[model samples]
Target: MQGDSRAFEAVIKSTERLVGQIVGRMIGNAEDRKDIIQDIYLNTFKHLPGFRHAARLSTWIGHIAYNTCLNFLEKRRLILPGENFLPEEEENAQASNAIESLIAHKQLTAILSEKLALLPPVYRTLIVLFHQEAMSYSEIGEITSLPEGTVKSYLFRARKQLKEHVLTAYKKDEL
Candidate 1:
């Protein structure tokens, strides 16, 4: 039992960040995120013995987190925000001072975050997995159960949409 507890602790330490990224991107509510993360960890512990070595441990854990979030969202009948999301006030805080370049960089990053929040959960997951986590298409496909082609296509669309939204928020003419 001590060995089991140590193994579980090691697993959580290694994969907690990956799980947090998935849960954070998919579920916006802080309270709901806590519940989802707890559920994910519980599920991971329950299923750990059954885990095969076919996939990377992080990828396997990520798959669990992604499915758990999907189930939670479905049960609650929640629809993640779509492209119609309004830009938050900070998005409009670009500066004109000597630090304009730095401020613009920060503003663009902020805009990307806001727009990313507006994407469908699938798109957000793909973006986070591919761009933020540096996972390849095959790895993402394994986690999402999407085909490699589908993963690539979805990632392309997500990037295109994010780019367009960011451009709209921070006008190209302003650069």
Candidate 2:
């Protein structure tokens, strides 16, 4: 994320899929997802200097993505009680089964999204960075300004919440 525009473009190209998935899960609509993705890129550029090598580039960009989505939600007053976003179409799914499969997928995604959204923004940010982006707790702490222990606690609670939600959904589906 330096020097040549090509480098920046490369970074975006590599990370766009992950960023879009994360933002799409947070913001839902295609139009808003695109807007939030653009905002993430812009913020990444603006904050690149302050991004010390304390965390992975992916984690750093993820921090930017989370903050950008929060700002967008705040600006629009769209922050719902729980995760209110929709999942994007899975590109690999076949046309015939797409609708059904997407619905099932969306249900799971929505459960996870709701649990994630219920967390405080700081913990939500940590969960996204650690689980979604596959960053280490230390790296997440670096990006979030939290202690490593606190990051671990947040992740633990996040996982517990997600587990409870999935279990509840599974039980409902069984009935």
Candidate 3:
């Protein structure tokens, strides 16, 4: 039992960042994030014994995290926004203007982050797993339980959305 606990600890330590990234991108609320993360790890530990070595350990854990976040979102009745959904509250377009200025000031990374936050949870997850984690389409599909084609399609759409936002938000010189 001691050895089991130690192994589980190692797993948690190694995958902490990946889990953080997954939960962070999916969940906008900090308090909900904390509860969801705890629930994720608890689920991971509870099911660890049954885990087959069919997938990489990180991938398996990531799968759990992804599903957990989806469940959380579903329970809250909060659907991920598609292209037509406007953000719930924005007093004006200052946020957009601020992003543009951030781009003009050579803060491209920050500007991109702001835009990323506006994306739907699934799109953000795809971007994080594919770009930030450098996971291949197959691996992402496994974690996301999406077909490879769907993963590719979603990723392409996410990138396109981001591109459009960047282009329309600022003049070419700003970039």
Candidate 4:
């Protein structure tokens, strides 16, 4: 990212999906989410010169993203409902669809998002980093400043609570 625009651009293209997934879940306002994404990249570029290979490059970028989002949250002092940041083109395609299964999938996604949004930011961040981002416990700990054991424990409780929430809602739906 330093002195090589091509390298920086390539990194941005490759990591766009990862950034989208992270910021999308945490920030409700699409505008703010977009701004935060830019901020993450800018911060990454600014600090690129000082980066040591203490962690994987992706992991380092993830740290920048994670911290940028937290700072945005702290400054805003507001948490909005979590959203599945589907690509705009895909969303447009889905909107034009007529298939039943597609409709059901959309509904399920919406419900799941609602349940996920109800979680506290910490648990939601843990779940996203662990499950959605496919990060290791150690990676998550590095980002969240939590010990690996604590990450495991919080993830356990988060999963349990989510499962209970889904089951109870489904039972009520059945009734």
Score each candidate by Cα lDDT.
Answer: 0.79, 0.65, 0.83, 0.72
Which lDDT tens digits does candidate 3 get at residues 1-175? 3238888889999999899999999999999999999999999998888888999999999999999999998888775645344334423453345554445666788778888887789999999999999999999999999999989988877876776666556755445
Candidates, ranked, TM-score = 3, 1, 4, 2
Q: How far is 97's C-alpha from truth in model 3 (Å)?
A: 17
Residue pairs whose backbone atoms clash in candidate 2: none
**Top TM-score: which candidate number?**
3
Q: What are the root-mean-square deviations of the candidates from the true structure over C-alphas? A: 6.1, 9.6, 5.7, 9.7
Highest-lDDT candidate: 3
Q: Please report, as a residue range, the 10-residue window in candidate 1 with the lowest summed lDDT.
A: 88-97
Q: If ranked by lDDT, best first, what sequence of candidates would result?
A: 3, 1, 4, 2
Work out the TM-score per prediction. Answer: 0.80, 0.62, 0.83, 0.76
Q: Please provide, for model 2 over 1-175, each residue's C-alpha lDDT reduced to its tens digit, 9 standing for 90 to 100.
A: 4655788898898888667755765675789888778888987887777878876787678667766776777787764323542222333323233333434655666667766665445455566766777777777665555688878876776665555445544546656
lDDT value for candidate 2? 0.65
User: If candidate 2 were superposed on the true structure by all CA atoms, what would the RMSD be?
Assistant: 9.6
lDDT of 1 by residue, 1-175 (tens): 2239788899899999899999999998999999999999888888888887899989999999999998887787776434333333333333222334433657656667898987778789889988889999999998888899988887776776675565555555566
